[model samples]
Target: MTTLHNAEAGDRDRKAFDDPAARGQLIRWFVSAAAISVPQAAGPVTFSLLALVLTGDTSGGAALILAMTVAQVLGAIPITRLGRNRSATWFLQGLIAIRTIALLLMAVLAAYGAPFLWLFLLTAVAGSVHGAAWGYLRSVLNGLTPASKMPRALGISATLNEVTFVLAPVAASGLGSLSPIFAVVAMAVLGAIPALLVPHVSVAPIEDTPHAGGSVLSPSILLWLMCSAAGGSAIAAIEIGAVALAIGFGYPPALAILFTVPLCLASVAGGIWVSVRNRAATRGMVVGLLCVMTGGAWLAAMQHSLALTIVGAVLIGAVLAPLATYYSLILDILAPPNKRPEVFALLRTANAIGIIFASAVLTATSLSVALLVVASTMLVVTLIVGAVSFKEKRRA
Candidate 1:
């Protein structure tokens, strides 16, 4: 571990490329990055589009999302366990190959109007594979990138995901008419490249045998995470409410789209911060982000006037970077380096599950009530976790 990489150290890190180890690691990272990019970019967007094409039903589209979330959670545990004991990277690559095959089938299904359930199930499987790949990439980053530069690496990874979101829509929506599966195939091809790069990452020679501890899930860590997640639920509720409030205020629902504009800008900017500045990844930032995210949501709710909500929306935009960065960093810090693939997948699952709960609330209750319920519950859990973590630290 070292201090922040200042100008000279960063220059050295840059020049470290001449060193064989650094050179090899960078090559591996970029190569895997290419493979991960297409799938990351196209999978969800295309899947939804494909589902709609197959059945012309929005519920089918919704099912694909729910399935992906559920499957990822279910898939992560076994994947992590396997990563710890096996050549998980190569194994993950194999999964990507399977995923590519699935996407192709989905293409066929979409073209011919196959059974809806089959199409949705395949979509879920693809999601599981994507989740597994994500976890693996994060773990690899933790191992290869020096502690001081990990934030930069994390920033690059998060930004890549953002790129995926932007491109998926364009490729699947616009160019999809020409070749629906082209986006998927491109994603699959790129997804597999990272697996090829995995063998290149030199596993540092630590002669010490690993401890096969009791339960891999630490009670304290789980407690903190669950608590954090609970409070964060409010952020989700508020988001839904914000959209409805805007619509009610007679500002077209599209006005809410402006919210993501700043959020996206802030996210990219935040990535640069983590990359260039030596910011210690801390739970404190996570708590702060959640609080701000919730506060923004609440503010938007209170601000029935479109103008006030817009300011709240900007605040919401600001919160995403810290929120995303914190969860990512926490996963990096807590999960063992090699076991990241599964954990990352699991993390996505948690997020998706959270979304599902939020969705349920939206469906069962009015949007405003849903937002209040999610936000209030989340705030309480966040405070409880903060208190517990403080006590634990003091005791330690």
Candidate 2:
């Protein structure tokens, strides 16, 4: 039965993509989504360089990112709800515009030898709109494509995003070496592409939907959100700590890509696999993926050898897309139709929170300790999700 449903869904997706108009809109959204992801993905490198220029230490960059992420978490739902009556394209554009302005101003102020505090505030301003922008961006897809096409659409988007994740940091590093301010300006300009490229999608006010009053964050929903955060933390621990991991492995900081590049390539492969498979994962599959990720985290944490660490990174990366797709698809099913923007906003926010958590741990602790903490967290989350799945099945 499941195979038949997936086959039908694949057929529908193919027919929809066969339409040039649908294909163009989806292609544009893919580009826009990739653009929107750049600032955040390039942030650690960009902000780290900027901080080094302003202050002698690089710690300020982490502080700025934390401020931005926290503000995003606080503003996500409220900012998304504000757009309930507006077109997703319009609202998303405005949000991107606001962030672009904030980033540009931060760059300008930094060039003038402005106070670091001023730069921090501007970073927060830019970040404040990020979660909502992502929410509306995700929401806009629903209008352009059918549910049957989502797995492919999301898989392709994930692949693009991983590519961005892989390349953005390199771009930021190269640009920042020339000038950190230039990198910031580049980030702002690239991020604004979404505002121009996103297709106009009309959205009905939340009040009009039949499921307008349904809860957005029930237990089932929280379970997936928790998994999303756990995955984010594990990934962040590796990416953000890549330099340190390299140093521990007796390599120069520039060799950090040895760890990061493999992870990203594996992630791209995972995304492609999801696209080709073109189906939602079953409960058992999800649980299996969760366990794979947990094992990956533990492997990286063990740090017995370089080969093992790289293997761990690969394991985690290989499962990232499938699990993330599951979270997004499940959340779409569980959330109120009218409140999807808010739920999706929370989804991005949860991932950001996980990144922040990893950042915080890295700040006060050694890389070894932080990896241990990340490993433990993923293990606990996997266990909890497995337990929940078991209970739900028994009830069914």
Candidate 3:
């Protein structure tokens, strides 16, 4: 590989700029990674509904998601343990194989018109295994974009998630209704295709250097991890609620798939707007998050206003696409390198927790009420962060 720059100005941030060729290379790789995630973000809808279809209305869709999350939380450390020594490629390839097999089984089960829950459980397992690919690919991307442009890169990347819903669900459910097996097979194929494009970079193997920092059980780390889990749970809550919103508003239950497709696309659109506008500073992001959560919650709370709900969904989604990525980058800027993955892992864990919390809230109250709480919490968090950021800025 060609050395782009070595000066502190260049190296302080770890990405390339000024080279169209490098940018092109980055685009292809990033797009390839993002492409695979399409199945990930969209797969749950199909899996959930598939469960409903194959098993009964009492499908394990929610349970499957919870199970997958449980697996994800448990899997993170071990994957990192293994990842720290192994090539990221090994994980990537393994996920593809695992998903391919699981999906194939799901297709077969559907073909046979097997028990709904059984096939869904199969799909859930496949989806869960594939989650590792996100962190691994993101690590690789950490080396791809310039420090200054990192936010934009991440923004665009998050935004592309919008594409996940575009065709997958419509195709899956629309066609899957007619032929479930074919839908499973197509998804399996799409999910596996990207592994081929990852370049063979000779990074130090996992065994070459031991993982940095403490064990996954370390105390300070655990606290941070819990917080991240909180956020993740919130995300899940919002996601489930969003689907509910789509259905409750008089659309066909199947329309959740259609609604999600555009939501994902819109997230990407929001990301692109941020990327081009260059407006994702710490304060801006916190503010944006607050705006989305609060606005969306208020809209949902109103319940009777379709216009308000749509506006809220759009506003809430606008911030989610790039929110996590930017937050991670900011943390990276603030923390030492050895602590990065642990931090990222913890944040992801927190997000899971947030989803759980959100789910609980939804169960206790209307989606609108739960959203009101979510929005308020988000707004408060953002305002506090913004205040701190301003203080820190002034101090500096």
Candidate 4:
């Protein structure tokens, strides 16, 4: 009986995707995902170069990035809430337009020798919309694809995002060589593609029912969010500290790619694996992925040998997509239907917070120490998850 029901559901999912309109929207969403990801993937380098051009210091660039991240974390929920009564696609496009205008304004002002402070403020303006924009985009996905096919859809999106990260940096560097302001302009232009490309979908109105006001931050929701944060911090540590890791391994700064490239390649492979499998991970599998990531962080931190460290990086990369996809899928189930955008916004904010945590730790300590701290955090989170799961199983 269960097998028959499963087969019938699978057929329904496929038939939904078979519709020409649905397929078109999915394709558009894929392009939009890649488009938006380009700016984020290239942001650190582009902003750093912009700082160098304006103030002759890269630290200001990091500050700008921090300001943007902080603003996104602070603004995500409220901004998403404001759009509750509006069309998701329209709101998302508006947010993207706002960000694009801010980026363009910053570039124009930089050309006119604007104060670093003005540039900083503009960066914040652009970043404040990121989380809400992402939430709406995810919400749009919910409309374009059926629930049973969501894993595959998210998997494809993840794969594109990984590819964007792989290429965006190189593109930024190439464009930055001409002019950092030009690179910023290009980033803004590409980032705004989603504004134009995102297809319109009918948004169901949230009826004024009591359950519509349910809290989005239940303990179960927090558990998955904490998992996301831990994973983000662990990954950020490696990416942000890649140069340090290379130097400590007796390689030149230019060879930082030795660590970063392998990690990215592994991540792309992982994304592909998730797309091919197209299934949600079980609780035990989620816990196991967490353990693998924790072990990877520890191994990379050990810095005992170059080969070993690269191996560790690969391990961390290997589980990234599976875990990320699981978080999205599970959170969709846990969040209140009416408050989904807020929950998804918080999901993104959580990861941003994790990046901020990793950045702070790296600034205050050595790369080795930072990685250790990240690893330790992941370990603690993993144990907590394990304990909670054990209790749940016992109750069952």
Q: Rate the local accuracy (lDDT) of all candidates.
A: 0.60, 0.89, 0.60, 0.88
- Kindly give the number of clashing pairs for every candidate: 11, 0, 33, 0
* Local error of candidate 4 at residue 58 (angstroms): 1.6
CA displacement after TM-score superposition, residue 236 of candidate 3 (Å):
4.9
**What is the full ranking by lDDT, best candidate first?**
2, 4, 1, 3
lDDT of 2 by residue, 1-396 (tens): 979977886687578768898789888999999999888888888999999999988989888888888889989988999998887788899999999999999999999999999999998989999999999999888877777667878898899999999899889999999999999999999999999999886553222113434677777777888888889999999998999999998999999989899999999999999999888899989999999999999999999999999999999999999998889887777777778888899999999889888988998899999999999999999999889889989999
Identify the candidate with maximal TM-score.
4
Off by over 4 Å in 4: 1-11, 203-213
User: Worst 10-residue stretch by lDDT in candidate 4?
Assistant: 204-213
By lDDT, the best candidate is 2
Q: Alpha-carbon error at 297 in model 1, in Å? A: 2.8
The sequence of per-residue lDDT tens digits that candidate 1 reaches over residues 1-396 is 245536566666456535787757865775575456575355556666655566664466567767766676677677556656655556667767777777677767766767778877887787676666666665656546654555666666556555555555566666555565565555566566765666534443111224223333666445544643553354355444545765777778766555545545655665566556546556666667666666666666565666666665556556554455666666545555555455566665565566667778887998767766676666676676577667867998
Where does candidate 2 clash, by residue pair?
none
Whole-structure CA lDDT of model 2: 0.89
Question: Positional deviation of 252 in candidate 4, in angstroms?
Answer: 0.5
Q: How do the residues 1-396 of candidate 4 rate in per-residue lDDT, one tens digit apiece?
A: 979977886787788799997898899999998888666788889989988888888888799889889989989998999999898999999999999999999999999998899988998988899999998888888877777677888888888988999999899999998999999999999999999999899743222212333589999999999999999998899999999988887889999999889988998888898889988899999999999999999999899899999999999999999998999888777778878888888988999999999999999998889999999999999999999999999999
Best-to-worst ranking by TM-score: 4, 2, 1, 3
